[model samples]
Target chain A: MVSYVETTALRSPAMWFTANRLTTGLLLVILLILPFVAPRYWIYFAGLLGINIIATHGLNIMMGYTGLLSLGHAAFIGVGAYTAALAQIHLGLPFWIAIPLAGVMAAVIGVGFGLPSLRIRGLYLVIATLAAQFILNFVFVHWQSVTNGDVGLTVQPATIFGVSLNNETRIYYLILFAVVFMTWFVVNVIRSRVGRALIAVRERDLTAQVLGVEIVKYKLIAFALGSFYAGVAGGLLAYFNRFVNPEQFGLLLSVFFLSAVIVGGMGSTLGAILGAVFMTLLPELLREGALQVGDTFGFDIALILVPLRETVFGLLMVSFLILEPRGLAQLWKRAKQKFERR
Target chain B: MNFFIEYSIVGIASGGIYALIALGIIVIFKSSKTFNFAMGEMMMLSAYFFYAATVTYSLGLVAGFCVALAGSIAIALLIERVAIRPMLGRPFIAVVMVTFGIGSIIRGVVGMVWGPNDLQIPAILSRSPVMLGDIFIPGKTARAFAIAVVIVVGLIAYLRYSRAGVALRAAAADAITAYSMGIDVRRIIAFTWIIAAITGCISGVLMANVNTLTPHLGMVALNVLAVVILGGMNSIGGVLIAGFIIGWLEAVTGLMLGTEYREITPYILALMVLLVRPTGLFGTKEIERI
Candidate 1:
């Protein structure tokens, strides 16, 4: 399947530049106006969508770019979140300080988990990550001194220039800023020499090693980079929800992010954005659909919708892997090509 | 001393059930070269089938067992035909994700039909506790253990002597060679799945009898995963040993420390084992010829 990258490569640079400018300008205009135009609750979801976008971008770097599968990504996110929350509560640190520190904490833990990748690959590595997930989750629950156990921890909102960014619109811009910055950062990273090394490692480590690339360093860097994004996203999530809990960062959440990366287009920035938005909106869409069906059928089907949504999500993941492994990014590329042909 | 003996016995019993489930997983992995992430979900489906038969339909225990077995076999066969069969020759991730999808679908369907509430399956065994010189064992646990052991033994024997079993082994060793030899590798893979579903179903019911049936019963896959990884994914003997080791560790740890520690300990053990020996004990170290 053709990706946007390939399609853009095929077109003239001048036209490609104009198209890129137009799309970015349009997207920026839309994003700026969305909080004002959309319902308040929808803005909240948009904030969540942006947070997930950042997290999915991180996952894409490892799974999509580096060909490393982590079933324990949520654990890293949890570490970032708990670290951020605990820092705020115990250390009495400001949100700005706590958030970056959370990212560092998650990155350190991520590198520790990445050590197993050096010894194992494929399914074995997956299990090692799974181990990280469980062990970290256990700590989150059992280490009550900081985490507060099942009761969960509340996160104080951030402040910038003595202005409390507590409202949904404020958080929306904060997350949007992070999302744009991280997306730009990742795009640059992918184009750089390190990104090339990562892609090379992904294709075949033996071949990459023969070519004089440092496989271990790049792999760990991918982990650190990915988890760093997760950490920042987690901090944002805690802020958005105003609460942090272990349950939110379970294996299911990790699976969701992994699925988003796969379903979006693994190695593409566009894919991450598309996948995250689709996944974030999917449940809400399902809830609405279920509500409509219930209204039409005269039944209280709301209780079943959550599980049904989960099933549909799973089904979508399978179908995408089977029929369109390149994900929605590829699909968008194809549509654009068709339009050009027309 | 008696308390220790009792927990050990209970551990062994639960371990037997774990072995039973792990057997199904190993069986599928052996023939298909794919891990069945849906194994636990398949077991949950079986438990639901039993609940539907005995509780919903008021069928007796025997009927419930038959229905559960049949239901799981059907689900497994359908999965193989629809999902696994198409996934052949595709990327390994596709197969893995398909199983994950299958699992999600099973959970969703089960939740829709049964709702989220926990349902209890009446104890299949007589309620009397067994007293062996001051060490008491619950009858249900003992019976479940015994049944699981019997099934494991029967399966090992089947794999050893049966013609279909030999064909499965041949297919597992080299699918292309077995196919060229006219062994019908596809049929063998399908048969393996059927066997796995049956074993998984029985184990699920047995465990559900021990603990009431819930839609979340599939979460037991995590613990069983530790058992499989520790024992070696490819070895039935290793799985059995590992299962008992983990089960006893869990019981002992839960008794000695807080119950919460039991959940993460197996994963930690698995991580340690994978770090030290990626191939696992008794697992053949895969060599890449290229």
Candidate 2:
């Protein structure tokens, strides 16, 4: 058999940046100008989308790259939210410090729950995370003195320099910065030695161990890293919503993130962004559609709108799993390949 | 002391129902290595079907039970054929998420059809309180316990002695060997789902009778996950004992600590057990190799 191998090495940082630099520059410019041009609701929605993209990135790392499925992701996010809230209220910390601190706290708790991953995987690990979800939520609701007992905590506006980010447009910039930084961080991490180790552990831990991947260390690292992203997102959420409540971080939200990760394309950063955008926009699209139908038919959509959204959400997950397991990322790749060929 | 005895009685009775639900989960897990995350939703859907048959359509109790059982079995079979059969060699997480997706669909459908408000299912069991010497047990609880125990005992006996049951056990033990031995592993898998749906329907109705009929009735399965874990996922009989233990723990904690504690105690115990002994009390130890 005869074969040929093609290899292209980057000559310089400028050359590396120049390849696809137009698209990257365009995306950054659009994102920068979005808040100013778009309606208030859209800016608010974009902020939420950015937060979701960050959290979904965390999940993609653990589930997509590391092959550890966590059902308690929202709980870790809750941990970060609460930690950020408490730090701001009690310690008088700024948003930057509070957000990082939230990440650290959630990472610690995530490792605690992730301890079981050493002994179990797949279904058992999922149940363990489910337990973490309920247990943490229980703590949030019952720890009256700390979490305010379901009434939740009111978060103060995050101040940067002398300006308080009290509005969506202001907070959107903060979230936008975090999203870019986190996305860069995640992409770099996935290309590094640690990322390869995590992926190896995910593929088959026994093999990874034999290959000297240090399965235990990487597994915990995956959890810590994933939870840290969740925590950071949660902190942003607290500042964005100007409130932190138990109900906001529930099993449903965790499932939502999981579905996002799946629908986006596992193990791909672009997929995470796409999935987050799809999921966030889906409900809005449904509501708008429902209103159009209602307006035309003269029937109340209030009754069916929630159920319809859930049904579609579920149907999307099922169809994606069945038809395109690689998710939207694979679709995009195929499209690009076809276009380039043309 | 009196309160303790009373709580124990009620707790154990409720535990019997939990065992019934856990049996459904165990049966499915034993045959196919897939954990049915939608088991709770299956139960809740059947309960809703029963409510629709009995209350909305006025079919009465016996006919309603029959309709619910058939509906649940059909749904279970449909799930196996459509969702599960295609996922034969897929990753475990994908299958698990598919089940979650199915569960969400069922919940949403139930909410749409029945509305989210709590609806009363016509009482199948007597509601009056029963006195056992000085300790008092609620009538519905006592009767539901009796029904659940009877069903569980019958199932245990069937699995132990019957020919079909033996085939199921054989398949569960080793699929290839069982296939070579002239057993239809696929049929057995479907059979186990039928058994699960039947058990889920019975327990779902019992739970709805003891509590209230709502879309969230499936949440009881969260507690049952604790039982399944503590008892071991594949252990048929261990769930019975673990169910009672968790039930009693919930009752006692609810009495002492508060109602909020009742929800979390099982999860804490399950987590502790996972950390300490992941195989659980009666579960078969999984041996992994390259």
Candidate 3:
């Protein structure tokens, strides 16, 4: 059984620090060393992993904490990227200002889409959320004047506090810090009053509603906060890549994000991080291995299997679902738990 | 007059195909409370099956139809056993997500087999547009419309009157009670998927002829989700009507506002429908007891 903390607030700081120390240490080491030790290609790949984490964790808030399935996470990210790109290009706003603003804009629109959750539940709610993705994607692709009419908008590299950071290393640190901060924010929220209410609503909305939870407000709040995370992620992605295209933020990306959450554990924040990393890099690593093997044997196997990316990815998801539904987060948790028990 | 009549005729013709796709979704939703997220992918797969049977091996229409239909039935049953049946007693979300996973898997399979290229479907009907007054509708689209109408009306009638169809209705309404009443709910579930596959195959072939057959064109069938929402999940007639409404709306809107607006219109309409008729046009209100 899942053992949530019994007390709403932890009384012992000692236990808290002791319990989380290993996790913190591991995260710190990964954060410090991976950027340096990883190859340039991997560094770029890892940065993309961070973006996936942002979106996956945001989806975790919606689908996990609030129990609202959103098929439109990528669409919201599209909103974020489009808004940030437009502001950066047309308004000449600094990257620092535009990204957060884009996040805010996406959050507002996320609430607009989230309004349906008040009446619809389960499968109906899912379709309703899907409508948001379709509507937004169409608007993004079609609204030519605002969205550059399918030829995507370009933005300049980011500068923080008058220090222009152009290289991937600096961008890596920026992305790393953003993800860290976002992770910290989500963890803090989980330990907060609002997060508890959100969790309660997800567990059973009627009970929560009967207990004076205000279902509509919470549903909308869940959507806005979740979207805020996605927008921030999307904004970061746009600035990092220096361009935004509609194709990059389509329904498939939405599916990939969901795959991450599912392959991670749904409700856990660490699950989001682990899922994003695995989902993003697994294919690249597989392809790399295939190419290396093909090169050694002097065959054309890699190109033949190159298009099987989604098939392999999908098969992995099914295997995970059938064999280990709890995903990578559970494995990490179990190992840590066993170590602590010893 | 020319533009108006032309758009309407073309509109209805395309809308007819959409209606068939919607019917496929409706049949599946009738049995499983869960939406088959892979329905469009199933359509694409069936289209490929038919194409391979006909064009790849150069088999004529009759042999291709029989083989494709049988293949689709097997595939649907296989999916039921592997992807769906195992998750029978699990949470609803688990089932929905699994269907999506299965969909991705199917898409990948189709991509691998079909080589990610557009397959040219042999013209089943005439290429020239049929002229009526100032309205000139494409010959194939009109033929597709005629075929779709026959299938819809025929199936709807069969479902309404047949004994087996009554059993399906009974099982769908209340599975446990139907089981106690000696109804084979599981068998009905299997039948639902088979019927859904047939619907998919026919629609797929029609759509391939309507537009070019591409693996990615299945994305359009994702719009069936909107139709299901508007019509209500369990309502077959509602889906057919909603499909026409959506089809005509898209055609008229495409005429008035442009093509891009046409795609977005369904979602916008879906949002409004969710706000107003949350249970949808025919869906009974779902009661949640905490």
Candidate 4:
């Protein structure tokens, strides 16, 4: 199969790009150019996309590659965002320092949540994760001194050395850099023995156990690693927005993040990137339709559009599930295959 | 004693609403083994239909409410046909997300049609507060609660002894075996959804009395989750018990800790319950592996 794989994909540069590192490298290069060519609003949006990409990738580690359905994974992002925001404000840590601290804090918190997976499995574990979303969001909202209730804590610009990341363009680079490193690191992890064991467990934990995989260690590791990535994404989001609010992280967004993975194609890192890009950008594109419809009706329609947007978004999600359940990444693969056939 | 009676009464009233929602949720979950995460939205949408029936069509409130039931039942079957049917035998995530998607669409359609403002429902109960001694009960909230309790009890009785109800229970217990036993399992599942819709419709009307209706009514999502988790996801009886517990707790928390804390309480409890018992108080424990 490996020899056949080389013969099929190696002959064309386009095929090589689609099937290998070149496409990934090109995508990174394009992401770098995004800030310069796009409007400031879009730059901020793209930075948000990167942050979501990070979270989706983290979720993929558990849901896709490792075969765990963590419905409450956004809570880890909450842990990272709120904790990093707190550390920056109270402990007076630098943004860079606080960001890493967020990841570590999230990983530690995730372990507390992940311990249940050692005994429970499947949808029950998903429900258990749902508890994390509610609890974490509650802490962020009720812990008044730190989170300031729903008002959220105001954040200062991220500083590295003496330079401030004062603009969306600058923050975009920081998010971009973080996403690249994490994606590369995670992809490498999936190629390693740990990755194989995680996949083995996802396939069948009992079978993996018989094959000498430490199910407890691997499950915890998946949770910890996934949560760490979510934390980093949250920290970046907090810093980029220059504010951290409880409302931004909720079960709705958690569902949104999970949907991104599902619609992008589960079990693939590239799929996470495609899903993040599409889901993040989808609202903006959808808003355009609302605007056009409003123009027809002769009044500003943004408020009315809010509800319609959810429906449209939902319709697209259902359509994807019904028509192309494999998501955009799978669609991309199919398109590439067709091109090569010609 | 007055305080206990007041808080307890308020709790049961609200719990009655949640218990109905939970019952709707449980009936569907028992059959399909999936949480109807869309329950809040389903109720919210039906409430809009009820509004359309009562006000737009000039169907008097009783006739309108009955019409709303028919509309909701129709919507449920439509949803099953359009959104859910294609995903049959797909992974659990697809089904869950589709419901979430359906929820989003419902909110949008309702908002688009109804506008963003909360609809001021005409008073079904008399404007006066009814007094028993020193305790004053608002007529609307109390009546809604009573109606909800009566409906829930009646439904439970019907399900326990009725042939159709028995078929639903049998199908829920084991789909394949029931199918071989000559039960039309798909039809039973569809029927459960219709029943779910009817319950959700009643919940919406009750909720409308408590708070005005908006597309954002879907935000009542946490309450349903709390009931299911607390009651045990698959148990109707458990749901009834948990519903009042949560409702009373929320009211007491609002009275004692203030509304913000009250808002946070149910979510915190859900988290605690998940940590302590994921199957809920009555849910069946699942087993896969480490």
Q: What lDDT does the true structure give each of the candidates?
A: 0.83, 0.87, 0.78, 0.79
- What tens-digit string does per-residue lDDT give for candidate 4 at A1-342? 001011221123233334677767887788889877889988888788889999999998887777677767778898888888889888999987898899999999887876764466655556557767877888888888778999998888898878899998888899889987887787778777888887777766788899999888898899889989889988987898888888888877887887788778777777788898888887787788778877898987877767766676778777877787667777887898899899
In model 3, where do residues sit more than 4 Å from their true spots?
A1-18, A33-38, A292-307, A335-342, B287-290
Which candidate, 1 or 2, has the higher TM-score? 2
- lDDT score of model 2? 0.87
Docking class of 2: acceptable
Clashes of each: 0, 0, 0, 2
lDDT tens readout by residue for model 1, B1-290? 77888888787778888888888998898998888989999998899899999989999999889988998999899999988887787655557777877888888888888899889887787768888788898998888888988998899789878999889889888999999999998888899899988888998898898888988898788688888888887776687788788888888887778788888878887878766776667778662222
Report the error of model 2 at residue B14, Å: 0.3
Candidate 4 has what TM-score?
Answer: 0.91
For residues A111-187, what per-residue lDDT tens digits would candidate 2 score against the true structure? Answer: 98878754556576788789889999988988999999889999989998899999999999999999989988987
State the iRMSD of every prediction, in order shown.
4.0, 6.3, 3.8, 5.6
- For residue B135, model 3's alpha carbon misses the true position, in angstroms, by 3.0
Model 1 misses residue B77 by how many Å? 1.1
The docking category that best describes candidate 4 is acceptable
DockQ of each: 0.49, 0.44, 0.43, 0.46
Q: Rank the candidates by TM-score, best first.
A: 2, 1, 3, 4
Poorest stretch of ten by lDDT in candidate 3 chain B = B281-290
Cα TM-score of candidate 3? 0.92
Alpha-carbon deviation at A249 in model 1, angstroms = 1.5
lDDT tens string, model 2, B1-290?
89988987788889999899999989988898888889999999999999999998999799999999999999999999998888877777888888889888898898888888999999989978888888889999999999999999899889889998999889988999999989999999999999999999999999899899999999899899989998988889898898899999999898888787899988988888887887779888872422
Q: List the pairs of residues colliding in candidate 2.
A: none
Better of 1 and 3 by TM-score: 1
Query: Under CAPRI classification, how is model 1 graded?
Result: acceptable
* Docking quality (DockQ) of candidate 1: 0.49
